[model samples]
Target: MNYKRLLLCLLTGYTFAASPASAFQALQPLHEYDKVSKELVETLEGIHYNRPNIDDAISSKAFDYYIDALDPSKSFFLQSDIDSLTQYQNSFDDALRNGDVQVAYTIYNVYLERLEKRLLDLQEHLPEMVKGFDYTLDETLNTDPDKQTWATTDAELDDYWRKRLKNRALTLKINGESEEKILTMLERRYKNQLRQVDQTNATDVYQTFANAITSALDPHTSYFAPRASETFNINMSLSLEGIGAVLQMDDDYTKVVRLIPGGPAATQSDLSPNDRIIAVGQEGAPMVDVVGMRLDDVVDMIRGESDTTVVLEITSSKGDTQTSKRISIVRKKVKLEDQSAKKEVVDIERDGKTYKVGVITLPTFYSDFAAIQAGDKDYKSSTRDTKTLIDELRKENITALILDLRNNGGGSLQEANALTGLFIPAGPTVQIRDQSGRVTPLGDTDATITYSGPMAVLINRMSASASEIVAGAMQDYGRALILGDQSFGKGTVQVLQDLDKGQLKITQAKFYRVSGESTQHKGVMPDIAFPSLIDKETIGESALDNPLIWDKIHETRYPVYWNIPAYLPVLEPRHAARMAKDPNFVAINAQISDFKQQVETYKTVSLNEKTRIEQQETNKANELLRENTRRKALGLDTLTSVDDIEPIDEDTFAKEASEILLDFIATNQLAQQQAEKKTAQN
Candidate 1:
């Protein structure tokens, strides 16, 4: 079955249940919301993969999630406010069962009140605060909410706000904004926050509260309001005319899920996954602070006409430290051709022999279902495109192949199964476990093995969903050596279901490898590991809230073509020695190590101007040193500063993998020759 088509159909049409509850004055749930809430709870309890018992335990957890969703940084509501609502901690399940969402509305109203009052206070006092700012004082601001405590009193919150506002102004000043401009921006930002708070309706509150409860079940499960469902459909259809990125609300920040391959952010900018979008600015406008902005509004601010420039201030966090960078990108459509699989031949010269290794870089597992439905003979698909590339590589007399699946955030499920068929003759690729505890094996029935020669499948932390399936299958059958970092542990499948109000994207199934291992929390490990730049603490499925745990079922019966593990002892040491000496490899590892050290050291940022400037300069110098070190090793011209460096596609990973493949070939050939000699001697 074509899952994409099914999902698109499911998401396209959604009906509104009732008018949302009014906000600002006295927030209360609409009378019709009771029935809508009842339907949502029933759907989730009946069809969700976990089928979790939404008891007091779940209700309590949901209450915490709801609180986090509203005031993630513990900035808005005070301890007294939470204390007053503590009675509802385990009462949410009962509220849902009775189709009464008064508690949800009440909590939201309380949050709205705190938010509006805070924004109003900021607006009134921002100018004076900026005027009285003293940057010379040595102080630090702990931005990590996890380390922060809830404000016990209103005065404590007031003090926190003072530092926060001071830090904001200081950051703007460092960015070369004039004092006047900083004041103006902060005033406008607070005004906007107040306006947004006033505009929040009952539907918005319901959606957030419902999502809080659903997220307690799993991260993938979510409720989309009517308008949000429409937005989601547009995104899935890939018709949005702007920077191609999947963004979701993470606390108060808009976080990047993944960048669409070939889009401006993916190709022209350095917008990595898990980076938080702090602010957005268009062509010549002043940057708009979007810290507490709604997800849809943030998306609207970033999106615009093709060729227009959108500037994004991105903050990437590791541990408790974050590095912020502003990137300007020219918006454009993410075309299918750009995301299509492409092949290259990497010629590795070793022992006077030039071994040509074919490398197929698959950005995503995509398919043009529309074209296929229209009876078009040639349709775009990962397997079809890859098979064509393999034939071309064969014509070039390539000795081996590498399926580069790095940062491929997965697309079509059928494509993954079909792509796996190109390697093995015929076998199950992955297993699906549904809510009813039924385990079904899905595989390629095709008997033809397209490229059975020595191969390696490259994966990384961003290689998720369908990517994991292909990599896991390759590892299971011993058909290809899996390389690079562990695959992203997102094995669950979600389907959009229409609700009485909005839509519910619920987790319906979980994916298991051919070897019966569930690729849920613990992703597929590479046969040979490489130093990864992607941070696992923030970017993988395991990093998400309440992710499904990894488990095992009965392993599928499949023939192992080769014993790749048996050759690992010899291969690993040789690979490691090369990586340690290789210039590019050394640079990559050094950069990763340097980042880890920075994360450890910069748990809190200095608010003092002189200290902060010194820190920035020190960081720049260290980065420049590392760049020069790699350049000098490669016999290239050394850059004077990190800013002077141009983007270079120095794929040391693939080059090293080619060397490993050559070793495997040589070792296997030697083993076969020795076996023949031993047979003759006997």
Candidate 2:
């Protein structure tokens, strides 16, 4: 079937049910098995993939999911496609049951050929195909204004990408360098740097193809070939045996964005964000040129058994270049507890009175899915962990609590609901409506309330999904004050549907707060808004290309809790007055303005001279340090050098939020006391 025709049928024939309650009943486990069997056969036979054993295993799993999703009972798949796809089921089963690698490989090759042809056809019609498309690729490459070039046409984009790919390939092949010579050079270069160099051409091609496919899908989803997959799993499990740093390909150079605390890099205290990696080596070995290499391949070279030594040649964000300096440390698991929420008591002394505030920083709403599925009694969920922390804070006489949800992408819906229950009384937390107009009311069954004091939620553009839910619910109920920049604005709910044996996460429904407002395109707006340093114009769902439109649904029933007046007559003026006098706020605003100017003037530097580039980088770093020192002198925390500000801790910002909440609470209490006095006098 043609792609367009199949999509049309699926869209028209499938109905989005009202709620999971009614729709879930129709889904049967047996139907899932049947669908799985069929998809597995078709995928194997049609694709003609090589490596039958791996193909069958993957396809079988993909089919199970595909069937479950298409099963009208469980999902909204079109019946016609389901019926047509089923015809190949037996063939897939036969291939899998027989372990036919050749057949699988053949199927895969055929599919790949078709895909290539389609892509080429699209390229031929590029100009017409992308007519009126408004999206622009993020200009992350240009750091200097004069060297920047923008492409607005599809043809231009296609040509640009093609050239980029070709250039990368040339770098890998060393430009007409003989295979034997190339291998020799690579081995000598990385002899001391890497454990081994897997210089196979096949490995390079596979990685390139995988990267291309993943880029086409989205920025997040990626295909990690066997060895790469093992590395990824290790990282996810927080059990890396090397320096704790996440690396990614950003143009020609591999950039470091995160440094896991307590890791070798973090302990060394030399490596910083945006630092370019130039060469790598181990003890008594020559440095290898890692520039222009695939990120995964470079990563493989970096990882090793614990307590082993590796040398890294790094170019600091500033103009200074440095060698490894022989920093060594024992590699240990990045304990999940390291990523867990941490509580701190921030005492704010204002007008001769000390106000004790509790600040809780939640990095991510992570849960042990494996343990949960296994029905482990002690499965760790965010809600349970947060509840324990809240109890501890309450005992310490915390008058207000600041729930810092910055950079928290989100996790399970069950935990979102449970966390919401902690703030508000037992009630409907959110409404989930599928395509069929069925609405499922997910509520909090727990009767206990954790913190009932003044509360404020700190979020930025990165906070999304379950984080949005909790923020939206708290705002709707007037139970907490929402502060910080606009949220990530992801209100859609994705359900992972198993395709034959593979997995497909589809946007099955839209989420609405108890008050019936969808947090889709319009994220939860803060009651008291603050300017953020990050660029919101380039972030969030609204900034995405071809994103789903924002809309609303019928309201759900929930009791109105707090009735805080919108017009905080004295509150706004008081905040304005305070901000005017606050040097920290003034400095923050200035820094934000400077960053905006810098971003606007961004261009690519073309200097081939190392000395010139080094000087420029040094100057820029010095300027940044000077600006940071100035801000610090103005009552903000001071950093002596740029290295002091390695990984940004949004906790300081969260503390600022807690102070704002305290101001609001104090003003409200004062007003209430005045009203009571007036009544008594009358």
Candidate 3:
């Protein structure tokens, strides 16, 4: 069988057959789970990458992951509890295989007890701390506790929790909420959190343990519970019925992060970033206050069958206060039109001539699978839409093209292959290596070149998966000059497997560039790396725990643009010169410096109101100075304060990439002229 089809069978065929007695009879002391545990443990040992020996060392790691999944930041479980639980570290694998999960349940039960006690402590102690604490004092609390030690004493934990509560209060007070409202918010939040924790079921424990086991293999490998699996599929197919806005927990409030490109929320335009969803309800149902609800719970309430309406009570901050708005949105299928390839032309003056540089911003590498399956002749996809945009841009007499993949997280592996086919005279685009070390060259064997003009690709740290594939292929073939920051390094391939109880997303393959270079930890480097807001140390595959290490294999033979090395010499220096003088880049450098300082010098902020306000005003002043620097460079009106500067509607990076495209044309044009001159002289 061919590689892809082989993977399809092997990956999706993973299922656990159960006996009549396989069901759990009790909450703890798992003697009854012998059959289920044996099956799961055996499946993982045999099928997972490396066929990991689940001995004491790996068992210890699994235990660590399981415990950490429940409590990262060392927020719960005191040192004594941790010391008591350390005995089970080397016993999990044996227990998992032998069907003795009493230890797992014991740990979980203890955690639950700790959680209950903590909540009760908070309920009693929060108001006392908020009322008694001297807010005018110069005290500080370290917010991030990634490497913090576990609380040695209950009194020590109480001190930590007191600061946490005080910080929460201070944040709201600064946001113009009265002490009464803040107290109410905190009470509701603590109560809801307690309620949610108390409601954890057996299914939740199993799923949590399953994920701990799987994620120990790799960060991407995960076990999705039935409801979660359904959600994942719905998202992947992009056929879910909901008012499509991505939401996140901002303190106690469910905040609208962003509307999906062509969803009902985006079309409505009433919802926005930083807007808090205070309440939600269905048509004819009483409005439920969702102010302190869990993000997932809020999402479950928001998503419904098609044509159904969800009313959201939103509040956006105005200066130091909040203003409310009621927005009703009808759920519908997400429209892919907005995410499709969009074309723009930028004119840049260089060397006494203006070059019309074409820009195509690809939001995602998507394919309308449903339409394709239904045998529609004109199914929507990245390659198809890109081809159309290129044709249109050619009609505009563009000199070069910039494929903007700045925020493209990538989708559809086939689309990446097809999109690369549009630029090159067809060769291997990517190499896939399966579990058996079998190498498969997934390429565009067809010899079709859609666009042969000078080209550049714009990518950032967010450009990942299929985006990396396309960019890697182009870079390998010398088809395009890759610009911007290094792309996200996610080269491992995974397939979703259906289990009896849940779904297991397991890494099955690794993707290699046509040049035999792997993009696992080391992503595709740019011809000209741009200053980025995303830090390499914080993001990318390398940052993830247990990521696949990069390695090279024998590269597939292919022709490439050999003149790229010679062409780059002139362009690099010219671009660097421009950037040194460019206002936008100067502003970016300053911001990057400020961001670096914030990350490095993370000293605790003073609780004193005057110092806090003064610091905030200073931050605003710096922000305004940076904005005005860019405005002065662009010859726009210089704003006096941060409030005067309007929201940036333009893609500043894309515009700069377009300018770089002009440089590409200029450099190539000069090279061609010199070639002709040398030939003429001969």
After superposition on all CA atoms, what RMSD does each candidate show versus the true structure? 9.1, 15.2, 11.0
Per-residue alpha-carbon lDDT of candidate 2 for residues 357-459, written as tens digits (9 for 90 to 100):
9988776676788888999989887788888899999889988999988767676788888888988888888888775567888989878788888888888
TM-score, each model? 0.94, 0.61, 0.85
Candidate order by TM-score, decreasing, is 1, 3, 2
lDDT of each: 0.83, 0.55, 0.73
Best by lDDT: 1
- Model 1 residue 54 distance off true place after TM-score fit, in angstroms: 1.2
* Full-model lDDT, candidate 3: 0.73
The reply for model 1, stretches above 4 Å from the true place, is: 1-23, 228-239, 317-323, 647-650
TM-score of 1: 0.94
Which residue pairs clash in candidate 3?
none
User: lDDT tens string, model 1, 1-682?
Assistant: 3323432443211111122333357577876778777887798889899888788988998999999888888988999999998889998888887899889988887887777666765665566668867798776777766788888976567667767777777778877889999888788777666666766777777777888788789988988888645322223322267888888766667888888877888877777777888889999987888877766778888888988999998876532244467899898888889899999999999889788999999999999999999999998888999999999999999999999999898889999999999999888999999999999999999999999899999999999999999999999999999999988999999999987767888999999999999989898999999988788987898888899889999999999999999999989999999989987788778878888888767767777888877877887888788889888988999887766875445467889899999999999999999999999999
Model 3 CA lDDT for position 580 = 83
Candidate order by lDDT, decreasing, is 1, 3, 2
Candidate 3 TM-score versus the reference: 0.85
Worst 10 residues of 3 by lDDT: 12-21
